[model samples]
Target: MLIAQITDTHIKLPGKLAYKKVDTAAMLKRCVDELLTLDPQPDLILLTGDLVDLGRPAEYDHLKSILAPIRQRIIAIPGNHDDREAMRGAFHAEGYLPTEGKFLQFVVEDYPLRIVGLDTLIPGEGGGELCAERLEWLDRTLAQKPDVPTLVLMHHPPFITGIGHMDKIGLKGSDGFAAVMERHRHVELILCGHLHRTIHAQVGGRPAMTCPSPAHQVALDIDPEAPSCFTMEPPGFMLHWWNGRRLVTHTAVIGSYDGPHPFFDANGKLID
Candidate 1:
């Protein structure tokens, strides 16, 4: 099975720009174009968070329209920029989101891999947290399918990324989340977003990572006092391929570029 991960889209209402510069909707359309053209297309798509810039209903409408070309089921969690109620109403028809919960968390058992999506959104705040309630729910949920290879999807990465500015707004209860992971060894990977750039770390010895956005990326500055900023870096997404036993990941960069150059000629001789 293959899964495509796209995050931090920050789609604003039609014709609006994110941060007064990036055209998130257009970028996302390009990313969607790339996804549609992939061979053996992804069986599923996961939107990690920040699907819109202001958590507005119209933005969700625009986002849905942009994502409409995708035929695969999409499972999305809320990022700090997302409003719980708005997102719930936007995707309620899909039926994965719990109808009466304060948090938008759910587990998907339809595929070969069990997927557990966690809500880390802290409304009107840039930071996120995994409070006791959410942590307990994750623990109990994982326990139910201990033998299944699972994928935990959360909007904020659980480890402190060296990018200090981003780290300050990182997940608050990471230690607790890690403790929960210690008991669920069946989790194959922890997929997260919000960093807007690819980052990887280990939580309770399990691999966890963040995917790049389809739009602007958090500038790669390493100082604690580094001013919060974003860059027009080459945007990308992630693909996780499960071959029955192990899950491998690859980063697929977007945009047209020079490619298909071969190291060998038609006769199989090295090109020199």
Candidate 2:
């Protein structure tokens, strides 16, 4: 099974620019088009968070239109920039996001791997947190499906990225979360977003990664005092392919680029 991951779109209403510069909607369109071009379309699309800039209903409407091209099943979680209620209403068609819950968490079991989404958003705040109740829920849920290969999804990364500005607003309660993760060996991958770059790390000895956005990216600033800033870096997404036993991830960049160069020049022999 193959799954595509796109995150931190930050799509605004029509004709609006994210951070007064990037055209996130257009970028998202390019990403959709690119996804459609794959040899076999992805079985599912995992949108990690920050789907919109201001958590507006209008933006969600536009977001729906932007993502309407791909026919694959989609699962999304909320980020700090998102409004849970509005997201619930926007994606009500999926019927997976719980309405009466304190956190928007769920497990999808229709595919080869079990998909678990953990909502780490804190309304009106940039930082993320996993409360005790939510942690308990995760522990219980993972315990219930110990034999199944699982993919844990969330909007906020549980580890700090050293990017000074973003770290201040990074996920809280990571140590506790890690403790819970250590007990769950079924977790194949812990996926996340919010940093807008391809970040790789290990959480509780399990591989974790943050997918890049379809638009702009946060500057790779390692300075301990760097201010909050973004960059016009090449945008991209992630493709997670489950080859029966293990998962392999490939990062896909947006836009038209060099040709799919031929390995052999009209011959089966080595090109060299």
TM-score of each: 0.99, 0.97
lDDT of 2 by residue, 118-224 (tens): 99999999999999988999999999989999999999899988899998999988998899889998899999999999999999888898999999999999987
lDDT minimum window of 10 residues, candidate 2: 262-271
Q: List candidate 2 stretches off by more than 4 Å.
A: 268-272
lDDT at 3, model 1: 97
Clash pairs (backbone) in predicted model 2 = none
Clashing pairs in 1: none
Residue 97 displacement in candidate 1 (angstroms): 0.5
Model 1: per-residue Cα lDDT over 51-103, one tens digit each = 99999999999999999999999999999999999999999999899999789
TM-score of 2: 0.97
